[model samples]
Target chain A: MAALVETINLTRYFDIGRGQRVHAVDDVSLTIGEKEIVGLVGESGSGKSTFGKTVVGLHGKTSGSVKFRGETLPQSYRPADFQRLASKMQMIFQDPYSSLNPRMTVGEIIAEGLRLHSTLDSKQVQARVEEWLVRVGLQAGHMSRYSHEFSGGQRQRIGIARALILEPEFVVCDEPISALDVSVQAQVINLLGELKETLGLTLLFIAHDLSMVRYVSDRMAVMYLGSLVEIGKADAVYFDPKHPYTEVLVGSNPEPDPELERRRPSTAIVGEIPSPVNVPQGCRFANRCPKVLEQCRSVTPQLITLKDSERQVACHLYN
Target chain B: MTGVMTSPQTIPALLEVRDLAVEFATYGGTVQAVRGVSFSVEKGKTLAIVGESGCGKSVTVQSLMGLIPMPPGRITAGSARLNGVEVLGCNVINGKDIRGSQIGMIFQDPMTSLNPTMRIGDQIAEPLQEHRGYSHKRAFSEAINLLSLSKIPEAAKRARQYPFEFSGGMLQRAMIAMAIACKPSILIADEPTTALDVTIQAQILDLLQDLQTETGMAIVLITHDLGVVARVADEVAVMYAGKIVEQGSVDDIFYRSAHPYTLGLKLAMPTNDPDKQHKLNPIDGSPPDLFAPPPGCGYCPRCPFSMKICDSRPPENFEVAVQHFSRCWLHHPQARISPAAPSIPRELYVGERA
Candidate 1:
């Protein structure tokens, strides 16, 4: 399989005043294959969103490189670089209510990409926008409606149509369904799946919901405190997680079955995620890990491929 | 009759709401937020109100707590009884005010709900001082004890810190400590753990269960997540368009859902169980507009099994099982066969990773 997007030791940091820096993404490497969906899951403040944003050039990388289709992207995106990459890469933001311009019509919002990246006239762009709207299960008449007029689900569909209008090969979705209601979340996920199939698009799906991510992705990666702790096949990582953090995470995720939930023992992790600004030494999850070893508090583990298996884990236990 | 099945025959409910109707006078028109919703909660039991956003789950509880603004929001019709004493339509209930002393509430976002200017301990103590008439020193000491009960590490040290000093999970623990400070009979948690991570969410939910067991207090948990509802709820009320579409025990709702909307919700969720693998059948359309809600069933446009009567008039609650009721025309004896609750959908990955 061809590598669609590759990040080699990608790191991003925000420099606060007083010589302090928040390590949002720290030396993380990941690869997304052509037509493959990679789900990235982590708790809030664990830097999953920052990682996605850094990979898509929404945030400038402090170090390392991002390679798309074997070509390296700029460390800091300029207007020219963004313009050049606009048609090939796109992003679906987390909050649908705030992502789209409130003043613009749905048609104008969807057609902006075409207007910026292509030579299409207003008529041509409007036609394509209407077609894409219908493709995403919305009516052509909805193109004239404002974002405020639509519900959360409808606004999300509009966001998808806007992103896909450019026909990008790779898309980074940052918690696209987290803000949505539970009933409407499935509709957006199914829509993304259907679109991925027809367009043969590769997606870097970033979300906090584990079950939904495992259901939609080919592979899953777990992050904690700006570092990848586990990456493996979706089913394998979910059902048989190797890393201690992943084990606790999967165990703690609540299932929708009343019998199973009531029957299972409580698997809550002990403490909150350590502050990313002042990241702890050694393994980041040691404070809350039930299976923590003394060495886990001092020695930072490297992501290594397990022998005789395709899974990669970063933990003292695995080592 | 509105949700008479909600009142079980064995024991009297600690909190009972009947024919509850609430509306907001918005700029567009009157938004019938809670349209004849009714349910009851017994002592030492949990009743979860589950629905999509804007479905009136929050409104129902807010109206009960007398938290809604009077001018913009009004309780058009309803009767709330606590231990057979009238709780609604009065400023006070049997010489006991209901808001904090009888029914305590914890909101979704702890940061926004908490006072940034006040210390965590002071905030928690405020309720005790105001409701229980405890002295400042006594309330402060009890606040530390409550924090410890919430499992906050170094409770004394943490209590003195402001809300900004606490983490998301810790802040929620502080919120829980404050809500139960007065040991209210009914605790209303409105999406308490929705803003926290799954790991932290598990902790908070476990703490709530432990607190309920300890105090024998009834809990009204309102959330949109079925997973949380299944985990914490003894009885579940599914709401749509400001109405209780279905009400039943957790098992009855999950395993033997009789309403089309309930079945649609189950089918839409992605499940890990391999035995139920199939494509998810998502509900087709968004909920009806509340400014001018549909004259008939609110879920009719989105229900796959909608009937002619569903579009013309709302259906009455039909008893499907013991203490289980569904408001749908399909549950009518003269109607066609009821749709079975689809088992959880198993997701199959179609692509091979590199």
Candidate 2:
């Protein structure tokens, strides 16, 4: 498979007052193959969303490069640049309540991208909007309805239609189903999977749910404190996690089984995540790592591939 | 044993709610938030009310706590008794006095729930001062102890800091410390772990379990997460459109579910099994509008095995097994004689056992 989207040493930093910078994304290099779904899992404030946004040119990169189809994208996306690439790569936001514009109708919201990027007239744009709405499991008649009239699940479907109307090859889906109800979450996930099959779309699915991510993605990447700790085949990373953080994260996720959940020993990770502004000198996870080594406190571990397997891990134990 | 009390084997429940019905009179119409919800909480046991966002789980508990504002919100019909004393529809049980002393509560968002202006210790100590009549100095010291009990390291230092200084996990721990400060007999945690991360959520759940075992207090956990309910709850109640659609033991709900909504909820979750990542079977369509709630079953529109009777009238509770009740028309005896009745596939609901 050809590499459709590649980020080499991508870094994004947010500057606070008094010369302090929040290292939201730091030296993160990842690749998404053609028609592949790469799942990104991390705790809140771990910079998973920042990395996704930076990849799609939603945020200007502080350092490094993003390559789409072997063509290097600009460091900062201007209006013309965004207009040019709008048809190639798109993004789906996390919050359904605030993502869609309330003033605009669902039809106008979905058609905005098509109108901006293409030479479609009013009739053609309306027709395309209705088609995309129906494609996303919503009725064509729902195009004229306001966002407030729909449920959280319906609003999310509208968000998906708006992003996919342009027929982008690669999309950044940032926790698309997290805001949805438990019953409706599966509907969105299955819809995304089906769309991936029919449209051959590559995705960077970012979510906090490890189990859900493994079900949706071909490969899984674990991020911690603005760094990628592990990346491997989704099932391999979930079942046979190599990194200490991945192990704890996967273990902590409760299965929806009564007997199994009750019988499993409760081993919660100790200590809270350190502030990104003042990141510690050593490994980011050293403070709370159960299997911490002496050197782990002073030497930062780089992400490295294992000797016999395709799995990559960032831990002193692996070394 | 007192003459007025019942026999030892038939001891009254610690907190018993019978036919709990709550209504919110909105501008559009009267929203039947909770219609005839009934359950009991025993000593040292956990009963989880599982449902979607607008399924009336929150309203049921909120009405009991007097948290619901009047004029618009009213307990149309119901009785919640604590220790054989009527707690609902009475002027004696003011929210301030009985809420902290007898029944403590925690909310979903710990950040917003905590008092940001006051020190963490002061907020925790307020309940002790008001309920237990403790001095400021003594209550503050006890607050630190309570923090330590909730597994926060350097409890003394943490209590002195404001809410903004603590991490989300620590803030939740602080909230837990405050709720358990009075050592209430019944703890009503409304989605306590929803806002926290997975690791942090696990820690909170573990703390709740530990506190329950140590104190021997009953817990009424309200959440939409089935995994959390499976881990913590001994009994499970599935609510839908303001009704208790199903009530059963944890094993009964998971392994042998009778309600279609419960089964749909279980099936909708992404399976952990790698070999069977099959297409998930989602209960299509949103829930019914509560402004003019459906006259029939709330799940009638969404149920895969919907019958004519399900759309016309609600079904009575049928005892499927010992202590297991499902409110569905399919459970009716005459339904088997009806034409084209689809039997619930038992294999789908039978989860893998250890």
Candidate 3:
């Protein structure tokens, strides 16, 4: 199957004054199949969102190539290039407050993308706007109201409506449900699931919660210190995670069951995540990994697929 | 942190809260933040108050801590008795004395809670000087030790720096160091790890557990994360729309949940554990508005199995098991036992492979 989106050695960095530079996303290459939900899971400073933004043309790539539908996207988006790309690829921001134009009514917010991408008439646009509002589980009356009038979950639905109005082939959802309440989080997740199935929309679901990612995504990718640690089927990575960081991530997730939580062996990884600016020379996670070998301290392992399996892990133990 | 400080020999309960109600008077109207909330934490036990935002979990704790202001925010009714003293109604609120000596609080954001200009050591040592009457030199030395105890390396040198010098995880450790400076009997941590990364959160949770073991102080944990509640809490109180919908031991709360709201929340959260596999059944709507709280059940509007009486009269506390109480008509024996209880799939609660 042809990939909907592909990247080659995608790297992004920020020079934070002086002689220092923060390596946000370093040499990451991945492919997302058509209509597939690829979940990106990582902790803070893991650069999952940075990678997502770079792919969606929100951030200029420091160096590398991003291909959409076999066409290489420009590293630095020009006005015409970005506007053209915006119709096919869109991004839903993590924060609901800052993402949507608070001044615009919900109708206007959803219609902006449609207006830019399609030539639907005013009557048709209004009809689709109201339809989208209802589809995302909002009342038609909510269309006239501003984002500030809605709750976090409702605002997120508005965000979804806006992102989908363009009928983008791919969408990058950056922590879309993290800010929502648990009850509302489930609602948003289900909404996304339903929309993905009905519209055949491809997604890059970026989140920190491994559980959520594992549930929502068909395949999951783990990033650590701005690099891919593991990528496999969500169940494969979750059921038997390969990388030490992935293992720690799976272990570190607090089980909701109290009995199991108490009974389970403690797998809390020691030490904090190293600063992205001063990342380790060899394996980025070597400083905190429990199974660090002598070679791991001096040589960084490349992500390699295991024999007869689709799973790929970047760790010396597998090699 | 000392269990000896709140010895049960002196007082029957470590902290007793009875029918606590907190109200906030806004220009719109009086918002009932907490209504008839009650729970108690024993010595060395952790009571997790679990709820979503606007559910009054934070307000209930703030009310108990005597942190609420009088004019706009008032403790309309109820009593919080600590050490044989009625601490509510601002009667025993010797701010520095009570809070500094008897109880300590750790807010969600460690950065904002800390003073930017002040040295980290001085901030941690302030409680030592104020409550314990320690000298400057002694407090400084103790603050360094506290920092080390929080697992921060180079504590002596780090203490001389400002809050900005420390990272988020480090700053949280510093906050813990400051909160426990006096070894207070109760440590109230409100979403201490919510802002931190997953791996960093584990370290913080571990640190809290270790501190509890050493000091033997009861902890009142207020958080929205069910996973966090499961990890740290000995007892769990599920809150909804400014009320305690369910209160029980960890086992009862997780294994044999009685209330529909608790079940909804449990089912709502996605589990990474391969052992539990099922489609998530999210509750239909958001929580009720506290400004004009429904006369009957606050959860009636959202409950999947809401009975007719659930909307008109608030369900009385029905005991599901010993020490397990749920405020839902579905659990009441007198209420019609319609086969359509809002129970999550039984398979979800069962552990097959574990």
DockQ values per model: 0.78, 0.81, 0.77
Candidate 3 residue-wise lDDT at B35: 89
Over B71-110, each residue of candidate 3 has an lDDT whose tens digit, in order, gives 7998888888886677785543456557856888899999
Question: What tens digits encode model 1's per-residue C-alpha lDDT throughout A42-152?
Answer: 988999999998998999999999999999999999999999998999999999999999999999999999999999989999999999999988999998989999888
- Order the candidate numbers by DockQ, best to worst: 2, 1, 3
Chain A: TM-score in each model: 0.98, 0.98, 0.98
**Which regions of candidate 3 deviate over 4 angstroms?**
B1-11, B90-94, B272-276, B339-344, B349-354
In candidate 3 the C-alpha lDDT for residue A64 amounts to 92
Per-candidate clash tally: 0, 0, 2
Q: What TM-score would candidate 2 get against the native?
A: 0.96
Candidate 2 lDDT by residue in tens digits, B34-81: 989888889999999999999999989988787888878888897988
Ranking by TM-score: 2, 3, 1
For residues B65-122, could you state the per-residue lDDT of candidate 1 as single tens digits? Answer: 7777787888899898888877776633333376777788899999899999999999
> Candidate 1: lDDT over CA atoms?
0.88
